[model samples]
Target: MRFYGQQRLFELTTSELERYREKTRELDYCAERPEKRLLAEECREMVTELEQRKNRMLASAIRRRQREEIEHALDEAEIDAEEIIRELEGESA
Candidate 1:
């Protein structure tokens, strides 16, 4: 099979991203060691892609469950935005 956009959807949740991010945070990015530095660079790139939704997963040719998850995430973000706005307004007033 062929994908036009060619970006493989890895089907990841936000929690999965968080886990990877946390795991990477614990790693020692030792500048003295080439391998460690390379690892750090690669991990940073991967996490950046994941956060940008450009990773090999969670994408446009999405399955039903993935679509639902995206919708739910947007809904939760909307609620969080509203709460933040309310808090800021309360603080100002």
Candidate 2:
């Protein structure tokens, strides 16, 4: 997968984007070497950008259920990212 911009994420369906973000997060957490971690960090940043775009889309969504779902997904992604960061920090400590 291309890890450059939100444009790729914008092209994906919400579900696909979420899955991609989650997978990227997992890869970030599993990175074993410094170079791998650097690449993972880049991917994580892309996912973060995608999340921001998703939030903007969520704001303009008209459907209540869709908004709620996106909100929930955002919350989950934030929590997951935080946890992974903490885990990585702990490993380095």
Instruction: List lDDT for all candidates, in order.
Output: 0.65, 0.72
lDDT of 2 by residue, 1-93 (tens): 224344455557466667767777777777887876877777777777767777775555446567788999999999999999999999999
Model 2 global lDDT (CA atoms, 0 to 1): 0.72
For this target, which candidate reaches the highest lDDT against the unseen true structure? Answer: 2
Instruction: Count clashes in each candidate, considering only residues at least 3 apart in sequence or on different chains.
Output: 3, 0
Q: What is the lDDT of residue 64 in candidate 2?
A: 57
Candidate 2 accuracy as TM-score: 0.42
What lDDT tens digits, residue by residue, belong to model 1 across residues 14-55? 565676666566555454677766776777777886777743
lDDT of predicted model 1: 0.65
TM-score list, all predictions: 0.37, 0.42
